[model samples]
Target chain A: MEEKNGATSKAGDWRSYERVLLPPVRDLHRLEVYEQNGGYEALREVLTSDKWDPTSVTNEVRNSGLRGRGGAGFLTGLKWTFMPPVDPNIPRFLCGNGDESEPGTFKDRQLMEFNPHLIFEGMLIASYAMSITTSYLYVRGEFADWISLMEVELAKAYEKGYVGKNVLGTDFSTDLVIHKGAGAYICGEESSLMISLEGERPYPRAKPPFPAQRGLWNYPTTINNVETLACVPLIINRGGEWFADLGSHRHPGPVLYGISGHVNRPGVYEYPTGMLITDLIYDVAKGMRGSKKLKAVVPGGSSTPILRADQIDGVTMDAETLRDAGSMMGTAGMLIMDEDTDIVSWLRRVTRFYHHESCGQCTPCREGTGWIENIVTRIDEGAGNLRDLDLLIDLCFQMEGRTVCALADAAAWPVRFTIERFRDEFEARCRPSLVPSGGVLTPALGP
Target chain B: MTDFIKDPVILMPERHPEPVFSTEELVFTAEETRQIATWVSQYPTADGAIMKVLWMAQEKFGFLPPEVIRLSAGALGMPYARAFGVATFYTQYFKSKKGRYVLDVCTCFSCQICGGYDMLHYLEEKLGAHAGETTDDGLFTIQEVECLGACGSAPMLQITNGPYVMNLTEEKIDALIDALKRDQLPFFSSVTLPQDEDDLGGNRRTDVRDTLTYSAPPVAKTLG
Candidate 1:
């Protein structure tokens, strides 16, 4: 609950922290407007001058403490270092994951929609860092409109020599293709995204071949989230130390907090990480709708564990604070619930989403999600028994850590956490067991 | 009724349905072929372009019938089964015929909390079609979908996988349905943050024409 003064100025104002990802530049999606506002300056500086090189760029990002904004919060610079040292004979690839399908997460969509060139610019810088010639920006199929907008902007970037072959008239060359994903949430998982790019059913592959080593046609590949890559230019421009100093020391840098549900004004707000969750729910989002008391919160996306209102009293939005508070800063898509919200029904709907979207790749995830949804549905419908609650918990244990990807874990966390945290609500809905726990039934002698 | 049952039924797609498009109509145009070629060259192998090609096919033919999927696979020179599996895996690539306007009502957690189901039920009652069913008029299809990532503007529905009509009320739904019946698609409304209203003069992006200011979510008529 300790407040970090990183985002506040001497005047103790929250608005003092400026927006880097979604800047206030008018028509920034346009290449000309972007260039006028120092859009490609980072890429230009990195490409043209001998002052910067690939390793230095990676080092700079590492120094910035920029974590992947997609969900995992892994250091972007460290991830860049994972690529097997570039071989002239071998080809390397980078996939910009724009599959922002996680529910309660819509920051990437707005970022992609408004300031596309920044993403393209970031991609160019990333390509130069990794010696990648071609990169794919994997956008979800639901974002067809955003894809079209990016396509127009990307073509404009290409025509202006900002992207495509020979970026900025230098020897360094890179190309970005906008790959549209069909409506599968699993594709947001990096390996599955690679498989989807390879024209397969988007099943996540087992790790240790880990995308950095082998991916996309079995070549060396690196996939960074869209927002993660978007921060690269700022890291390059402002110097890593400056970028690292903006947010919490551990998880520093500006983050787009997509606050939604039951708030008076729910929208994507850019703020430095480590802003108090209370400040976010109250001051930033303009408090609860209808002056209702806070009930519960899904601190990150739907996948992250839901926390009771009291649990988030002094918690900040950074990954470490949220993790310590028993929820991860997952995509920073905070779903706020008011006192009137129905926990059981909400959990049921969330379980149903996991069931519906499970790729059916692993038996645990495929079967477990369906089973979990069914149990929750029955519980929500006032069906029998306290044992079912135990069964739900048991099913979560069985599903977690048993699948190839984290999808199973993601599916289990919300169900397990919601039930564990809101047991009273769920228990109230269920009828007691017919048989006493220690009582034994007499066998029929005639039989 | 509870979804929990001893025997769960798995609905299968029709193995062989009547062809919606003729052989002549099924073929991609020369321009489309060239566009497909550009996409094909973008990838190291033709397989990588399968999704994009299938998307293009879906756009051209409306939905991916078996023959159209085959056509797409044939265009990419990949296996038909592979194309079919890819087609079936993703929900957006519709395998069957749909009404002109598919109202994908988002009833995910955030939207659900903010009357997503209420908006869905309202549409169901008004249109006389349950979720996932097309109206007899063949103009509208109501679908209860998962999140489309527009949680900020909850209780929203997308029109035929295009523009999102967000911040829904019964009146807005009525107007939307009326407009759609008259062949009007909703324009994309960029919902701005409250912070932007205070700092950036209401909107950050000046290029966007239609913008919506975020407001308090409406209370649900039914929590379910």
Candidate 2:
């Protein structure tokens, strides 16, 4: 937590930190350029060499300690192991989740646009390890341009015998298809993504039947984030031990920290996990815009709890560190807010987003999101009493753990945590109670 | 208090409306039929290709009316109601007529904190139409949309759900509206990261034809 800005390099400069996911190579999106920079070599090595098998590859990823980059920080290799043993009679699928629709997250877009071949290579490697014949990359429809670009690149890969039947002349055969999702945030969820791929309304399924057990079309499937798959090739090439020693010991490997909102340099920076929050905002993002005092920071995407400026003194960008700091490392897309930002209006907007994207599947989520949005908007408009604050918190409790998916919890967390952390701000916007004493009416009122 | 406790209503789509296209026009062209067949082959079941085929239909036609949705469902050999449900679930699928250009302004959390509503209001005033309404001239429609995954370039808007015009300003909006008036679409501009400016000579992508550098976001005019 002592500002590990230059810890990775002897030069004591954060810029010296090497970018693994998005290397400093130009034209990496093209097949030839990516191959020149050691792109599909990992896939080629895995398919041809006797050193790696399905189990060994999974073990390497598990040993690397790489977690899911799409909000949930579950172990990628462990998730792969959950898949029932491969059967030739049944078809298994590997879904590369490119549905990067989270409000404050945009790093996956950069990866899909600029370094698409890395993702393809990673997917191919993962397919070989999982013994999956067909893989689907579900990209959000808003990324039509990127999707098209990736399609062209994928076709080239297929033509070169990297993805289609009999990959690299080995027995390993896999088909990688790019499935475009029409604008739904819920499809970003693993089960919902599978349902969307199967041409159904994308409502998230219950957790008893996880994706690995029964996924797309009721086949054993494993879903990995686009950025998470992009790391597979790196782990294969450089060894899992090297990846394990790259960043935070608990959550190792390079992560794409997408810094946005009130920052001078608001863009995706590839640094190892566990980068200091202060260094990210101050040093990496070139300090706050116009030198404004930092008021709060949403440590991850909008669903992650917002941290007061004082509370993030020694916070780092890792799952455990952020969890210990009373937030989740949900995508690591930090939305920084300056002192001038109105907390009430900001929370209102955040609540409105959840309300707008509730998907209407569960009663708690559909109704709870609407109720939360109405209450927060009233508080924002200075038309609420002090009791409304308590009411809002109570509403969150009703919705938090009583839903089909995390969307309800996502809707509830911002309202609950924002009021808990910034009660003074919400109280200032609300009208004072008419009855002064708690549970006691004034004598004048009785008269 | 009345606003907070409003009753919920399920507004139904038109059950029987005048058809926009005739029976002859509803049929897909031979080339389009071949394309749909190719999409169907990629999925495990024919239904999996419903979204791609529907997207193609929306592209060929201006929007998806009930008949058009039925046409797409028939092309995929699926039920019409299933396709309709899919279309309604996604906001990108145009269920009705829209302007030549649909400007999706991102006013989500990141953009909101960085003057997203300011740009949205500017467009509303310039076009004489509020969000979700097409302009009177039928040239544009301004929609205040959720995040399009480009939060780094806050205050951005997507033109016709296509190219993103990022890091928006008043002057940029004026120029964009004028160009769009003349039926000239803006070029795709790649946003270069700040680290690329120092390490890789201002732009990291050599394949990109145009690039926009990231700068400090402008302050919001009104938080509300």
Candidate 3:
């Protein structure tokens, strides 16, 4: 086992790696196992150790620079601070964004499934911080097994007085409920998730109410992603400074990045902030797989713009730096694309996804996404001219910043940039493969 | 009380027992009840948001029957169609009773390339039912869904309402189905956080890459 920066990295073999990093924690979904492992020590620590003050906890988190580990890297402490100060008369809400609907992202489900107790513990601490009594984890509808696992964990937490009335003999009582979202990607968005939790179409509500001031029944609500809540336990257990020490000043703490595509090792790698994209690819991922040449990467998820191969070396794995590189780390979903990949076809595939998944609530996104898909499909299948590319770019431009939600923008940006970065590649896909295209003299539009 | 077994179990007498909505069945925690009440207040009238409430009720109980839907409508002061429209409009909203486990596979383009159909076929053979059908054992429900957004890890399937299992081969699919059949929970994949592909097929967990290690800190560690 190799250790870097006080964190373990098992790289010699898969078995060794899983053993050291993924060590099983006695199946603590049961109360007995959890208590044995010092499960609620943090809760106990927070409660009795200096009489846990909600403001203190919130202040520590704010200082630690823990950002939401969901798609958008919103500052977790800032989000916590957004909650209206403790209100006893009004019902306070803590929503767990289990609607893991972003494409290429299922880390939250894994967190809930394997270490559900961890998330439950996080919820307890968060509920403690917010002075909230009622909380709901809005899990994706399809995650029935995970929901059950969470229920079991909740029962365990309850048995140990981690939840339910008079938690850990503290007057700060909070109850956690598992709510399911009916299959909508928008539900993963905080406002939409709140709406969905209230049992409406999983669509984003206009901001300003923002779930902090008015959410989940028009009261103050604090919604954190499952991973965000999961991180809460770590923050509480180990002091905030320990978490701050893991990553850089910009984006502190360990981020579980889901690496996939043409890479030799494609899985979730939790690295601290300020890690290089080169290290993530070369050291962590062990380079590209097979004879495939590296092409571009969707640094975040499909929504993020593609980064050229040359762009990999110094690209910081944090959100702000990646945004500076012309792509937001929308979600830490690094989708690798080999040289053999056709950008035209891939873009079309993503366009089709956006079109299909469009909630139809917004017309520009609903129509523009479908239009881009049709044009891109024609281009990919050898039925398009240069005009089609211009038209596609135009459609993307229109959908970029005009929609009520970012869904449209998410679909549009990748297509626009893919065309810009690899225009010739897309154009190459245009001429029928058999049609000789002057011996593949490709052009690269300036980035 | 109803038995755990899914049979024509009698909750009522032979002739006709007035099915009473138990406090446990209809009632929720004060917080949950308040949530339901708040959702009801969203519409122009109290009855308008009744279907939304029914879906919420279904979410709480897993499935909704005509009785529950009607009860919800009555509770929310909505008409039957409005409530039924809410229940029946969304694909996730269950109308007729379904099997215990619902297997939703991504049959979209990306998954198709990665052998989604083959896996679907395998599931059909394994479950002894075609898509949109349930098995005679009444334990599994299989349906093909649009993309669940893990295109990076294609050929994915969500098992019996669990995480999306991706990077799928026949063997992995078989292992997953077997696990579900035995009522054992399967492994969870944290491929990435689904961001853009929100609604259609996002949030499904996929295959665990053999070499991929979750939770490696940013800096490489040197062991003594």
Candidate 1 residue pairs in backbone clash: A1-A314
Task: Assess each model's interface with DockQ, reporting 2 decimals per model.
Answer: 0.69, 0.72, 0.12
DockQ agreement of candidate 2 with the native complex: 0.72
lDDT of 3 by residue, A112-166 (tens): 6556776777888898898888788777767765676677768767777889889
- Model 3 clashing-pair count: 30
Which of the two, 2 or 3, has more lDDT? 2
Interface RMSD of each: 1.2, 1.0, 11.0
- Deviation of model 2 at A197, angstroms: 0.7
Scored against the true structure, residue B139 in model 1 reaches a CA lDDT of 90
Per-residue alpha-carbon lDDT of candidate 3 for residues B73-116, written as tens digits (9 for 90 to 100)? 77766676556645643567676557877788875543543356
Which lDDT tens digits does candidate 2 get at residues B151-178? Answer: 9998999988799999999999999999
Rank ordering of all candidates by DockQ, starting from the highest: 2, 1, 3
Ranked by DockQ, the better of candidates 2 and 3 is 2
- For chain B alone, what TM-score does every candidate structure achieve against the true structure? 0.91, 0.92, 0.65
| Candidate 1, B1-224: lDDT as tens digits | 68576576876676766788888898889999999999999999998999999889888888989999999999999999999989999988898899998999999988998999999999999999999999998998899999999999888998877888889999999998888878877777777766667767877667677899888888876766
Error of 1 at A240 (Å): 0.4
Looking at candidate 1, what is the lDDT of residue B181?
Answer: 79
